[model samples]
Target chain A: MSATAPRPNGAPPGAVAAARRYGEVVAPYLVLAAVWQLAALAFPSYLFPPLDAVLARFFAIVTSAKQFTDVLATLWRILAGLAGAFLIGGVIAFVMAQSRTMDRFLAPILTFFQGIPALSWVVFAIIWIHGIELRIFVIMVMTTLPAFTFQILGALRAISKDLFEMVLSFRPTRWGRFRVMVLPSILPDILTAWKVNLGNASRVVVVAELVGATGGIGYELLQQQQLFDMTGALAWTLQLVFFVLLVQRLLAWIETHAFRYRAASEHSL
Target chain B: MTAGPGRLEEPVVRFDRVTKLFERPGEGTFRAVDDLSLEIHAGTRVALLGKTGCGKSTMFNMIAGLLDPTEGTVTVNGRDPFREFDSFRGKLAVVFQNDRLLPWRTAIGNVEIGLEMLGLAPQERHDMAQRWLTQLGLGGHENDYPHALSGGMRQRVSIARAFATNAGLLLCDEPFSALDEITGQRLREEFVSLVREKRKTAVFITHSINEAFQIGDRIVVLKRPARIAYDVKISPDLDAAEKEAIRARILDELSA
Candidate 1:
């Protein structure tokens, strides 16, 4: 019962444990950085820039107003597209879960869409859509919708029948069943879906921008390549990698807090 | 019998010729409960003794309003529980074999779930859940999640959840069989005292003869297909030897 009892002084056991877990996570990245620096020393500046040079260029891009706008613009497109996919795909997934007939009808279509690559969608969007922003947004949604829908559907199906029976024994109203049972049960799955789609959204947006857009980091990367500014191109690529990692870390933090109950309960055992 | 206040003379639960059929893939229908008939009066505690797959759970589900009888009827408080399902809202609660506590919710949060479904105000529900957890010797662990607690502690939270609803009837399906003998015995004692204090009518299913004798004022043994093998009323004044004799008789019926 005193599994969670705090010590008389200093940090709680839970906090200390979390800190150690985070340290384990960061340790690999440090090793990767060391390897990258070693590899950079063996290569010429034109082909492979040193880590410090890339970092310096990354800082310059981040500090400049015009380049920063490009970064923000790409981030906005990815987020807006993700939001739309989540809303539309969530409803579709819910409908599919509730009715067998609907699920049967829609399963094939979603499967087909899932099989189609992000590059194909970007190509299709370029040919069909007029505006660069709209094209990029459409491509991101196209690439992410099926994944989100299917992942959410899988989560819905995985819910325990025992939990459902326990809730039904209470004789809750329809809304009450959804609020008290359905929603909470699927929340962890929803976070997982978001984590997956976050990577997908960022990847597809960059591809779309690289192929069709006049603005954003992808566009800047193409411009740098055409001007033979490999250093600038490498810098933008490094910035892109950092952005992805930052977003992933932020999401991981959210996931940790959101499912902290799971960690707490599991550790107590 | 130590009946609670305002105990009614009429039965609170009555199963008349109830039968349940389940369809197995590639096989024909299987009869889980076959023409079962029983009556449990208000404020009385009954233990249903049955082996695995003897349809104890099927019967328990019928009483809880989760399944309909393939034949005959099941009535709770004089209403058909399946047909009048909503009418039984807040009237009954169940403690399952496993704790079945929501892993996401804290111990007190799990306890307050029924109250939430009953539309009790958040503050009131929180306070009531806290009091119940305290009563169950889990005061400081209210904020802990189900995973954090031991199996016994989780089961206690589950019992508290059922009791906090203040339901007129409690249905327990081998609620303590998972625990060790000592913890199960301790919890059973705590549970029986709480049920007596609340004056709630309870039907508990157990395979153990000792558990039935320990918990029930009346014991109904069920054979496969769910017909009653033995129906006996237990007297509180029975001596240890008399209790042993009853246990032997129930064991014979169970084995037979």
Candidate 2:
């Protein structure tokens, strides 16, 4: 039986299903906002600003061209770093999957880098790189490379040998084998890695900006904090949250469209 | 077009003194196929009948070039499939025990894979894939993914994939073992008729005596360590009682 059986009442099931799913996602955020508002009622405004005050400041920042530029700058850095990490990390992962020698040589190195925190890299970048943009980019890439590489490697390893054998029986070229078998088999994993590293790279970009960068949301956040502008800090924090959620939603939308062939039960997180 | 009688006289597949050994982590080594030699002519349908772990799949893998024999030579069309893997690029196809359809691809997409490998034009591949899927009774389900199709329909898609390649040799590794009896019978009939009409050389691997009787032009019963225990040619003229007797004899040989 089809998993998405149409409703008996002749309504479009796709619209109804989408609405229900969106409601499920929004419900928790609404509840969390309510809880935050209640907490704001019990605290002083300077220490714990009300939701409305923070939101008002958030809107004010969003409307200002300079403040919006800060948001764009942070986004550009994160996207650039992540795009580089994805390309470099994807090549490394493919090499690791194809060759045992490469896997052995790279496994311990990846593990070592993974053990070093993003903050440590930010400091190292500050010492090593004079340019602020390069420093933030380096820190973001270092933070995300290991996770993307390993996730792609795991996806490569999880491909069934039986399927490979079946494809092999057709005697495809190495490139054909990869296109018809490897790429499709590991696509879900690649998308998952992209989602994970997007979140990670976003956070690391902010952290790197906080340390030494001249411009971005993190820089604005630091400035607001030093001046004891609690509402502004909270508003920037809200912007950060909104940025992360926006990226996640975009990735989710891409995943749903790209992997429409996946069963409903196997929907990605 | 009907396949002319006795058109396939040349030996297309040969196994000479073939042996395979597998090493377990702590269990040393186990012999999967011993020094067994066999030859199958072109356009002949042969069934290698054996139970699980009886080396039927191992033998199939040897011919498919996924595994190399440790002790002997396996040649397809006068060339070693393992060593000269590229030589069989468009000449061989396999229908695995499981459908093995790529979950991310629809029925038509899955069927088009071999054509894609063969470097057919997009329109040509699309037309070929669509025709095969439709011929296999999956006309309207071509857009469905494997998860959306039933077990039987998924197997049909797999069969369509193999046929779409238009390969000269078809290797079936228990292609219908996962389906229910009725579905299996229907697919087996369709598959047999297609194979005969196209005059393709086929090697079907199965553990069922009845399945062998139904589909095999010649049946070879394999004993453990995989030597041939019985080699019998099936004639279309055999009565029901004679067929039953042959099945009983094959079962006895397997049990022995």
Candidate 3:
């Protein structure tokens, strides 16, 4: 819901404001599409296919089960990796936040992960696990650790000592402190971190599938490229981009509502 | 219900030779608060006046149990406040300079947080928040975000939040310093009336002599480094003319 009101328990008062915000966002897409169509007319058809061709390919991918299955596979791998990362990386980040020694120990490891390319992990995965799922796992370990650890660390650091004092002073049960203070304070940052991870993850999935997958959009694209079907390759690439955009839009909706609820609750106080 | 709700006669927070020190790894020690001693009796409204960095906030922080004195102890109702942070919080409500309301929670929710932490039922907490919001001239604006509220209105919300818990000691650190002078005056009057209505003890730390005169039962001025230079009991029954004279005297003391 659009919670534009300042306080929590009170009713909201600004539907007009929300409508304006949506209008501001949707207006730009029309401008972008016009610009893209105009640019397509200038570029060689090989490098930049007509916008209609890309849209047609995107529609076909959306309609087909094969494309859906490939997309789902990539999503599943990312989700599994990220879930594990939150567990492992969250604990590590928390420990690092609490102790200087732990921070010192983990900082270099995280830096190394962020600095290295995801493709390198795919090579290692081939040597170690020698399979597509293993390659996906490698991508997960590489992308998930950096995003999860840094986001969590950033969240922890962003929380004010005043809030900590408030938690400590209230002497709420450990669970209550986490529920009331730590979770709310860190959520926006964690959500932002997830968005960053998704971008990386989509890229990682493409690399993983291109190098090792038996079936997937990236594998399909690689095959088309091998056969010198530039139209099919570009078509597959555009579909993948559209999928990433859809995920981003979904995350945006979730964050806006969640933040509004939180903001309303705070405003009431 | 009768007003001045929890007015009591005994001291609730006692700072006995509370000395707070800070030292960097290679630097000499800096005495933030030096051998500071004070007592806040219930129902008495006192102001701690000092220039910035004169240790007013440090003293309040120690009372709030956010800091531990390097030497001596802070006893809230004969118990070390730092020993049990939760219990200390229960007995004390603080309004910081920055109005440390949770940015995510609304005004009512902010007011109800302590009650929520106390584990009061959610509906009852909502009722209490509503009552306070209305009383603080924020009846219709309960759902307004902090950013949406004017500076003066936000202070009112903060005051309401502190008073809602009915804590024995209310520690306010320059809460109105950021406000315009006229609004600040109105808030001071409102605050004094609120304290009188609630009968709660308060430690209002501010640099404004006008504000000190407006709400303070007792004004304690701190000079540089952290010593209470002047302790004066303001007359509770000063008329407009008498208030002007008192204001002049207080300003003279401040300038000196």
TM-score of each: 0.87, 0.88, 0.81
Give the DockQ (2 decimals) of all models.
0.65, 0.69, 0.22
- Residues B16-37, model 2: lDDT tens digits: 9999999999999999999999
For residues A223-244, could you state the per-residue lDDT of candidate 3 as single tens digits? 9888876667877877677777
Which scores greater on TM-score, model 1 or model 3? 1
**Decreasing DockQ order of the candidates:** 2, 1, 3
TM-score of chain B of each: 0.94, 0.94, 0.88
Interface RMSD of each: 0.8, 0.9, 3.0
Poorly placed runs, candidate 1 (over 4 Å): A1-46, A49-60, A263-269, B1-9, B239-249
Kindly provide the TM-score obtained by chain B of candidate 2 when compared with the true chain B.
0.94
What is the TM-score of candidate 2?
0.88
- The prediction achieving the highest lDDT against the true structure is 2
> Against the true structure, candidate 1 has what lDDT?
0.89
Question: A122 in model 3: Cα distance from truth in Å?
Answer: 0.4
- Candidate 2: misplaced stretches above 4 Å? A1-65, A265-269, B1-9, B239-249
Fraction of true inter-chain Cα contacts (below 8 Å) kept per model?
A: 0.84, 0.88, 0.28
A180-240 per-residue lDDT for model 2 (tens digits)? 8999888889989988888788778878988888889999989988999888898987887
What's model 3's overall lDDT? Answer: 0.78
> Please, what are the lDDT tens digits per residue for candidate 1 over residues A180-212?
888888887787887788887877777888879
